[model samples]
Target: MKRSLGTQLRHLIELLDGAVGAAYEEAGLTYRPRYTPVMRALMQNEPATIGHIATAAGITQPAATQTIALMVKQGLVTTEAGVPDGRQKLIRLSPQGRELLPKLQQCWQATAAAAASLEAECALSSTIEAAIEALAARPYGERIRAARAVMVDSGKS
Candidate 1:
């Protein structure tokens, strides 16, 4: 029998990240797998606020903030208050981060190629895309709640 959906998805992430993280370490890069989206956002739009970063990265503002904070600690990025609204933090890549871009870009290209090959072999890219679209239309939480209601009404809960 197959494991739970969430568990399987999480395990997949662990496996993928483990391999990707190893690659980063082998390259002598102090980057984390979780930081890719934020880094890409910053690469394209430097000196951007946390809100903008969050939007570009398709992640929550809090997650962007935490990632930025970690990057700052690692001397990979810097943060300053935004103009007009000093409360907003604007993030920029540090000199060290800038220096690592070429190598990171190479790594990114390799990773992309590997992912494309894996998708071609597995044929799951479309399925995953559709799943994302479906969930966007109706969240998993809503489905779960509806199922639970059915079970309760049927005296099976």
Candidate 2:
């Protein structure tokens, strides 16, 4: 039986994530792949609530909370009470996390360059942005929504 395109796409996503993680490790960084998305979201918008980060990162609230706890333990982020919602906390990168931001940015750039180089060297034929646009133009938002639904169904959210 032939494998479905969804299966192949899933595998490719995993491969890309692993490759990015390896690139960061090669750069002598501890490289927590799970934390990268969280950090990226935070870097894009500081002082965001944990719930906001969870929604933006497409992760469950519990997962986001766990990630934030780990980051706090690692001194990568700090949290304080929110003004509007006293019960909710605002998360921001710690001084150490801020210091590492530039390094992380560099690692991402290196990873992108490495992938581009491999695609060129192997003559792999695929336009990534075009593929993304095509995915985005799907009738029901995108395949990402389907994936997220699976995650939700699995009690992840």
Candidate 3:
């Protein structure tokens, strides 16, 4: 039996995230890998809107919002209503978060080195990038719907 592509992708994430989580734990840092993109975005710019963070992090706005909420609860970030637009929220790193930045940046550097080592051993990064580009042109949902039509037409569904 062979694993499905989705299963393989998920397993890969689990393996990588688990190891990274362990590294953070050993470093005595309380952090989540999901927070990395948000942190990076905020580090680059303060008083950022959710949309800005989303674009900077290459993540959806909902994900950025959720991560920001969690970070706020952990006292890692502060959010306030935008001065120009009361409805829009601006986010910035809290003092605690800034204090942790140096250590987090070091961990990120180490993680990148480890990831590069893995990339040297495998074509993982390039393949994922290509897949992302291909999917951007024709999304997976569209592909699935086309395949489903074929299955229905052939009475294979």
Candidate 4:
């Protein structure tokens, strides 16, 4: 009856995202946490391909593509043909998106401050960072397989 680690992590992320989304709505900003990576990628390097954005945002290509489609629909970004390869499309912030940057940055700062306050109390940020680094060094799947092998050898199922 207990939830898995993945499920618990997802629930925590959803709760945090909901709180941040509510704050954005209250501030009259239409921003969402999901859009942050895309915005940041474009802000840092405009006319970037979806692959480039994905790498810069630390997300998968499919996720970056989906986010780009949504951003395009929202008029927050525009796409143009890549210069070197006309078949490739490059993404950039729209004029509207550019205009919203200042407010977005302010909201980002406030959100960061709120997260910092929570981090100070709970050390959640550092803990999560350490966990990520540990996992990167040795993935959970590797650990799980090794444990399973040991369990089977001991007839523990």
Candidate 5:
């Protein structure tokens, strides 16, 4: 049986992430590759709201919220009520998270170099950027819905 495109894409992501995660382990860092974006966001935009971090990381609000919760649990960050808005919570890295930054920075650079090498080998970055642009113009979900409608109509006919 042939694997779907989504499955293949996820497999590729997992492969790449595993390599990076291994590198982090080698460096004695207990970091998940997925946490990089949120950590970087906190470094550059401390005192940011969940919305800000999500946008800065180009991730969904729920994803950012979940990551933040895990970070808090791991003592990587702390959240408090927003200065002016009691409803909004501001997030920032903890002292431990700040201390981990130096190592994280090294790992980030190494991981970037590794990803660049991979991209050079296959031009994967450009291909992915192009795919994202195409999807922005015409979302996959909309295309799928249209195709399903056509299939249903044809079956009826």
Candidate 6:
């Protein structure tokens, strides 16, 4: 019996996420699934405000704040007062975070290479990215609010 379209898509997502996670783990990196998206955003745009980071990463403000706190405690990020707005905090990679940046790049590169090596690889890459872009095009705050609503309503949070 064939799987439903939604089931197939979900399985592909899980496989892609798992493969990347396993690759990073095998490389001895201590990256969390939640942190990967945030780290990628930070790597692309350093010295951004926490609000901007949260928006870019498509997570709630509190979620971004918590992630930032964890990263700061782990010595991966540093925070300072925003230049123009003293009320807002600016975030950037710490020295240690900067040092780990190259390793992060290498890990992703390895993952990409592995994906390319797989059979039917081009279609796999296209499907994954198109799905990601579709999700990314949605309003981040709305998505988070909806997800929170569902979790709360279902009492499975």
User: Would you estimate the TM-scores of all the predictions?
Assistant: 0.95, 0.63, 0.96, 0.90, 0.94, 0.62
lDDT tens readout by residue for model 4, 4-30: 989999999999899989988988988
Q: Higher-lDDT candidate among 1 and 2?
A: 1
Backbone clashes counted, model 6: 0
- How does model 6 score by TM-score? 0.62
Q: Highest TM-score: which candidate?
A: 3
RMSD of each: 1.5, 8.4, 1.5, 1.9, 1.3, 7.9
Ranking by TM-score: 3, 1, 5, 4, 2, 6
Model 3 C-alpha RMSD vs. true structure (Å) is 1.5
Better of 2 and 5 by TM-score: 5
Count of clashing residue pairs in every prediction: 0, 0, 0, 0, 0, 0
Candidate order (lDDT)? 3, 5, 4, 1, 2, 6
lDDT of each: 0.90, 0.84, 0.94, 0.92, 0.92, 0.83
Q: Candidate 6's residue-wise lDDT over 16-70, tens digit each?
A: 7887888778888877566766788898898888889999998999999999999
- At residue 52, what lDDT does model 1 achieve? 94
> Candidate 3 residues 39-138, lDDT tens each?
9999898879999999999999999999999999999999999977689999999999999999898899999999999999997899999999999999
RMSD of 5: 1.3
Better of 3 and 6 by lDDT: 3
TM-score of decoy 4: 0.90
Q: Candidate 2, residues 1-157: lDDT per residue as tens digits?
A: 8878789888988998888888778877775777987898898899899999998898999999999999999899999998866898999999998888888989878877877898888644466556756767774455679888998899964
The regions of model 4 sitting more than 4 angstroms off are 1-3
**Clash-forming residue pairs, model 3:** none
Candidate 1, residues 76-157, lDDT tens digits: the string is: 8998888897988889999988898898988899889989999989977898899999999999999999999998999963
lDDT of 5: 0.92
The segments of candidate 3 whose C-alpha lies over 4 angstroms from its true place after superposition are none
